[model samples]
Target chain A: MTGTAEPIVMDLKRAPNVHAATQAKGEALRAALAAQRTGTGLAAEQLDALPVPHRRVERWKHTPVAGFWSTPEAPSVQTIEAAGSEACPVPGLHAYRMVFVNGTFDAKASDLPVHNGVRCEPISMSDADAGSQGPLESTDWFAALNQAFATEGMKLHVAKGVILDRPLLVHHHTSGENNANFMRHDIHIEANAQVELIHWSTASDSSTGMVNIMTHMSVESGAVVALDKVQDEAGSLQHLAFEQINQAQSSQVRVHTGTIQGNWVRNDLNFRLNGEGCETVLNGFFLPKGKEFVDNHTTVDHRAAHCNSSEQYQGILYGTSSGVFNGKVFVRPHAQQTNAYQQNGNILVTDKATINAKPELEIYADDVKCSHGCTIGQFDEEALFYARSRGIGEKEAKAMLVHAFIGDVLEGFAVAEVRMEVEHRLAIKHGWDTWNDTLESA
Target chain B: MVNIKELQASIGETPILKGLNLEIKPGEVHAIMGPNGSGKSTLASVLAGREDYEVTGGAVDFEGQDLLEMDATERARSGLFLAFQYPVEIPGVSNINFMRAAVNGKREHDGLEPIKGKDFLNLVKEKASLVELDGRLRNRSVNEGFSGGEKKRNEIFQMAMLEPRFAVLDETDSGLDIDALRIVANGVNAMRSPDRSFLVITHYQRLLDYIVPDFVHVLVDGKIVLSGDKDLALKLEEKGYDWIKEDVIA
Candidate 1:
């Protein structure tokens, strides 16, 4: 175990010079830790051993941790009243709600009644047993930071042959300026069990805040799991999320993520297929406006033979916003008969907006099949002309085309309410009068 | 209802429609026949308000309104339609939704309320039968995976739904077989009324046997050289366009 030093000196050679902001943040974190009390889990000393990410790191190459991690301020506590179901964009959908405010579980705002074949509770650092060390043993900076400072998060377990009738909705709401939040969630689905999860993050007030969340999911043999995540934070907030998924033999897992609004957001998703006959699907859609920045990085490892995976990500950028997508697939030497596919497509609404996308595949088995494709361009002129010639206005035509471009990703959502909510949000973001009117009438 | 005078247009630096003049009154069906490069498509494109062509010296009047000043959507709303020679394929936009948008857009432009959902669907079914279009294809994406004959038939189905005052059929019979051509021509003839007119542009005169145009014009070198009745189209078909070029040179 690494011990905390009195005066820490960061390695400037290993860290990129462009991330001066992150260096300043590290100094602030050290100063804050010196003045605070230590916790039971991975202590501040273990976090000090992990290095902050720089441009040199392959995972963080395009998305530098400058303005997001640096300029840290003392964390502040806030009290929030119970919000109504209207706060949930997809109203009328039956779900088990778990609310968190400023990284602490708000029991009063949550609806966590006991159910059959399932257990749901919040675990603190002191209450977590030695068996919870699997996810906390990671050496990544973000994971270490989460393990060190996480105050409260949900711990869920589903018994064998149990099928959840309603989805689990986890809502994270932040308030107060300069507040930092750290959260961790662990979910385990037993053999032949099925579950659906919906996670959403939003800011209660227009304040500059930072949120770091880590989720660890394990699916046993013959189990099925579906997770849908939506991030619609205020422009003054910064968010970072990491999801680690592991699958057993014959397990099926699907994940859909939508980043409709944010200032600075990054999602790191990694899947480990350790069992043969496993299937995985990942779909993502992001729309950033103004000076917002959004990045999605995903990796799928096919360690066993006869596994399959497919991934698709689409982005629509407007104004001077920037977007990034990096997808990687790896097939080990013994992973024969593995099939993997990846695609990334982007549409820039304005000349000032930009996108950076890279799709990579590594295969050691000769019998495996792997392919990737990427496209970045403006709207099709001929399609626009065809729409206009049918009496559709220019603005409506553009909106229709954009909607069609992302139609596939939207249809991947198994929940109808979630799909409709996302479509409504997209219409409002793009200022489509025709769609707005149609939504109102509907 | 359409009048074109000395319509000189060019795409880039190359001139396509040079000094082309034509006129069509209400309740009249006219045909324009010419060789491959006689600018028949350019005439249709310029009238549809395609921005690629620069109108150097010409004027088009649709019901005495300046057609050149209006944009493509505005022209469609004002009762002008162009059945493209090669219809574009839109993968995610359904054919039914496309027709509803075209119909509702024109209605909205005329200050009318949008059509009801059930009413709009009934309208689509009625117009689809005019061209013998399949109901499955109507629900699919616009022109996606449709055969050549089906694509041409979809164009006519759209025209029927919009009910435009003036329609320019640019080679509607280009890729159709005998049976498909008859179905398409019947769809057009069924829509003919005193308030609407048609401009049938083709390379062969077989289509004239079905729609039976009242006037036929021979276009050569970006200009219409001869104007006569439907008998002239038969004569030109018997003697290829080379004779018309030789007559113009002499």
Candidate 2:
């Protein structure tokens, strides 16, 4: 019942000296980007001047970034042995798989299916072909770090009126112990283009690396995009990811972020509705067991009129794990007739577990319907009794109830195979008999 | 068979069932008619091993096993079933999956293999039709958004699926329309077997008219005052419980 210990304050300006090897790698990446004239990299001085967030910062209060950047050894981008395409976690998932190992693109380990009207390739600093100024680039500390140090990522472009038959998968596999990997992915969806994007990560059990990812997406008019991001890294790994989405008029976007297994994970998801008649749907769930910590911060800013956005995020914490969820919705004065709703729900399975949830809504428009709420509660005893009375064991009943609590968000996955894989993993880890798995096998 | 001897129970410090006694042999339907708060539901809950009702002193034997020693799940797996008066509505747990788990749980308890998927599906279809439960209700979350009659029928539907040796129906007739009452009664009647026994607890004699209990007991103040045949129910329905209360007092 006691509060957490006072956060440790670190002198980030002295970080360059301690992490000199990482700084030198960033300089090399900046030179490469400058040579290609991509204009995506920040100057060395600007990158050094960006302040790394600490516990004192308001947004970073719940999730401290100092520990995310701290390591016993100098964190540098390093490549290890590649396990080929068989290393893909979801073997049954059939997608255009692009595999990356320790933040570097592995061409031999990826299946690059060439389809008409789709340009998907590993971003190269030497080639200017897969180049574009992305729609949204955050000046935040984490994004700035990624912009300065990112060495390898993917650039995807879908031509107008093109609908992908299969999903595009960006799979990150980490094997570098005590190392840092920075990745940045750019996605461009032309008008009327429909595509589904899946970003998934897995790491070796012995790897205690740091993986920072920044994703920027732009959707043109009448385009529809579905994004499913899953982070199920090793318990020793630390993960920080930022996603920025810019929607044009009449664009429909849906995003589902699942932090199923991670020791420390922080996600910042922002949506900017820059056009009218756009529809934005955000659904996410996190399961933090043991001593894991997961923090999710999201913002949906409606700057255009006649836009609708709905966000729902929930988590279940067990053992001594803790979680934090902060969802904010801002409806500008000019964005009349905007309907924005946000909800955050959590369940603590153990007395030692905790969850801090805050849902904020700022509606300046008069003729708008906006609602935001949060709920933190324990398991439903009556429901538990009901299931057990029907002959289900207590532990199995609890497992089923936990899955049910997060079912709606998982159902939002654009790919069925991906959903089943994640569900199977969770069931195996939690000793749950997933009925659908049996039904499918039968 | 089920036997109860000096069954005493309570909630907190307040006693609900004070030394009630009852016994049921195989192939018999015994209906206990009582006034409000006469420990009718308490007896049903205690029989089903509901944790909230503590058995302060008493003994319950089910098929040669000490029933009170088992938890609710163990009792259920050991062939004891209770159709709740107010069936719990569990959202996000489909009725099909719940029933499958229940059926498999009992089978495993009896050292039998799990039911085949096709056979389970067939059983669900067959048992559901007994109560006129539609396919949609079978697929939806357990008892969620179900009407009163539908919830009761679902209970009987589950009873048919589980096929427990001893069944307790706690106020199964309340809040039911005449048509639904007949349908529910028909489902229960169809499941009557020589190997199974039932304790039907209700306030009205209306349900007795359809199920046709072999014996009728009048309960007042946590004790049974009189026991009779089917005609006693009609008499109690026509005469109202005042005469019985007077007789007990005298």
True contacts kept of each: 0.56, 0.56
Q: Please give, for residues A218-315, the per-residue lDDT of candidate 1 as tens digits.
A: 89999999988888776477788988888999999999999978888989888889899999999999989999899998888888899999999999
Clashing pairs in 2: none
**Regions of model 2 farther than 4 Å from truth:** A1-51, A72-86, A129-136, A437-442, B220-225, B234-250
lDDT string, candidate 2, A2-47, tens digits:
2311111123423423344444444444444446433344434556
lDDT of 1: 0.82
For candidate 2, what is the TM-score? 0.88
Location of the lowest summed lDDT over 10 successive residues in candidate 2 chain A: A1-10
Specify the poorest-scoring 10-residue window by lDDT in model 1 chain A: A1-10
